[model samples]
Target: MRTYFLLCLSIVLAANALSDNLVQAADPAFTHGVASGDPDRESVLLWTRLVSPDSPELELTWELAKDPTMQTILKTGTATARQEHDYCVKVIAADLEPGTTYYYRFRQGNIVSPTGRTRTLPRTAEHIRIGVANCAKYTGGYYHAYDALADTDDLDVIIHLGDYIYENGATRPGDSYYPSFLATGRQHNPPHTCVTLQDYRTRYAQYHQDPELLKLHARYPMIAIWDDHEIAKIPMQKSPSGEPIYDAAWQQRFNDSLQAWHEWIPCRAKQGEVIYRDFQLGSLVNLLMVDTRVCCKSKVDKTEASLKDPNRHIVGDEQLAWLKNSMLTHQATWNIMGNQLLFASKGSDWSRWPGFPTDRNQVIDFLTEHPRINFLITTGNAHNPHHYVVREKESSNILLHEVLPGSISSGNNTEKSRSNPAKLKKLIRAQESNPDLLWYNNDAHGFIVLDLTTQRALVEWYFVTDIRQKQYQVYRAHKLVIDVR
Candidate 1:
């Protein structure tokens, strides 16, 4: 018994020593961890945040390696993390091989941060897989969907369609907006709505603390765009009465939010560039991401006159022209648009593309003119998964496909859809009334997996069994295919 006890004591002592060494080696300066994004053939963007105790400026050393072990360094550089940019460091690592996986890390003195893995865009490939997600509210539930995607090794990139963090406060027992019965232990940090830069930063820190989300960012490069919740519940530059709503205060708040967003997200943007940009994944796909919440002109109104207005602009005139030019010039096999709202024309809810019918129809006309091109629109903010085949009005020919992934942990549509069978039947009948409506499911909460190839693009929808439970199973609920050949 004495011999066994001594052995156990020695083992415990060794374990404690190892743990202390690890703690001593780690750098608490990088509280948010490392991330990489916006990969082209020859370059990619790397990001990290340094927490300075006394110095306003900290020198951070970054290294890129071709292997996960980082034995062979491809590139190394030094960047200054300054207080002007919230102590955030963004470096562009160039001269990288196309379609090659690389690992990166940051160091300051003897402390080192966690390594992040990212890959460059392929110059040419036979197959590419992407993970799509959106509407992740910290207070809604756990981020199991992100965890699942992080564990999967087949995905080439991740496209996030916004609402990354909700600006609202804690949910009480009697809140009518969200399902109070489904509230989890997670809650916002500020305990109030976010309006200033500090408030937004606090909210972001709270959301980034989730291990699943951090793991996902550490594993894959992400392409993101913001929606309503990031700025306001219903963000519009103009009011319903046709007056400018973005006054000085509102503009400042918007600026604050944008600053925080740009600082945290690993995007390929210069100091003054807009977020909308295009990525060419070799000859297989052309990916375009757009911002819809910032420059939109009018508030949502369901009246006939409001819908028929020719001056209404959802993406502004400049972005619209740019989109058209990109569509006309791209020669890839497939064109995928990362949008924030649904494109199908629906009932009086005019906050989506359906509200701006003129611009929407213009895009549809462009798609109709080019029958050989396979256009796929991936959107979020619906909190429900939908598959729609939009078609030309007169000819009834399919123009494009819109795939919407369900929310990460937001309230399910089942409550509203199952309240009354008669009402549900009426809703279904109304949806089927449109010739373009193909599939709709609001009962589940999950993300989507998009598998692209030279022949066809397959969309697989996976749903978490329950959002209330910590440990849940994800099962494939639906699959849709678009022939690209």
Candidate 2:
């Protein structure tokens, strides 16, 4: 425990002493820390970015060990961090044992990165625990939630739903919802909304400078998918022609943002930029990570005619079909959907699953007919915690459960409810308005933990008391136990 606190303190002090660009430290230093993710039974992806005062590219050796002391080395390899990849190195430590914990670190001469802990997927398991989180904007507040998650020792992996980094400037232009977004004494580097690759990379670097986020990354493997804010909310906008625009400029911007995402996020190499993937944790859990915001989504249309249109799909035909197929193929005690969009409706937000009524009904119908699948859809983007029940074909019989772990630090209704009586009334009225709302919390900064077993699954929400201060307390505010299994 003393060692843990010292490590965290060292990281925070190092972050506090960094320059504006978060660079110019040593000859070749690990400024952003180490992270590992996308683990299979045999391999897990390891990542770290090097900051140098002289060289644009540096060679470093990474070692994975069975113990924390780095005595029993399992895998050792050398990698070159080049300027093209923003000096980020991602390498797969293959031939690892299943369900085994490993420690990894990068070294260049005398410089050594902070040791990161990671675990590969289990070949056979009776239980598993995962942390779920989303919507952490650097300008919104401090990342105490991430620090709290780091303190959780039982987590095997963390699923970042989306909005990992908000691309909005200090002020989001004409959007009245966030006139001056930077209220927590934090600022975005580059001082504008991300557009080009450099802009996105700069934003990611700024977020990386947070000691809490860095500590969380080093402590646990993260499975992440991008939301609208990661790419500057591109899919939400439409041109004057009333049609979704995919012009040349948009394509370039998308490519740039995606490149930055790939550079920063540690994940297994797929065919393309596809992040919608599945992970099987022995026979206990099957995690279906789907992209509902970016890869295959259309502009949001709230009109009744478009809502129920069979052709208008928020998840698109290809991804929806893949989602259903993946569930069918990968059977486990719990089938958890890592959804980026809200599955339940919240006020007039048509961007939820309700926006595509036909597809939503189709998914529910498929789950209903199966009858054997114990399903849970985990989503975010609202920055609020929600618990909802979806019925079987709108019948009395329950079909599936949906949950939002709540946002890490993105701007939520806390200030609005505190300042305005009408907003507070609406928050109260919101729960009263919906019969499916089992629980709702509009004001909080936190993360969720999902524990899965053969008999039941427990989802617990942990909220921090304050994000304005680095030192705060975190408590388990709510818990939902799904015993349908």
Candidate 2 lDDT score at position 17: 41
| Candidate 2 C-alpha lDDT tens digits along 297-344 | 666666877765666666776787988888888788789999987776
Per-residue lDDT of model 1, residues 1-485, tens digit only = 11211111122122222322342333436766677888888988998877675678899899998666679998999998887777778899999999877888888997676777788888987788888999988877788888777666567789999999888987766553345235457877788988998888878877866767877777888888888887768565576445667678987777787788888888877534778888888888888888777655566666788788777767766787888788778788888899987887666557778888777887877777777878899999888888887777787767788998988876656644544568667776777786677888857788889888899999999888766668878888999988884
lDDT at residue 209 of model 1 (Cα atoms): 64
lDDT, candidate 2, equals 0.79
Give the Cα error of residue 106 in candidate 1, in Å.
0.8
My TM-score estimates for the predictions, one after another, are: 0.89, 0.91
lDDT of each: 0.77, 0.79
Which stretches in model 1 have alpha-carbon errors above 4 Å? 1-28, 176-183, 239-244, 270-272, 299-302, 415-429, 432-434
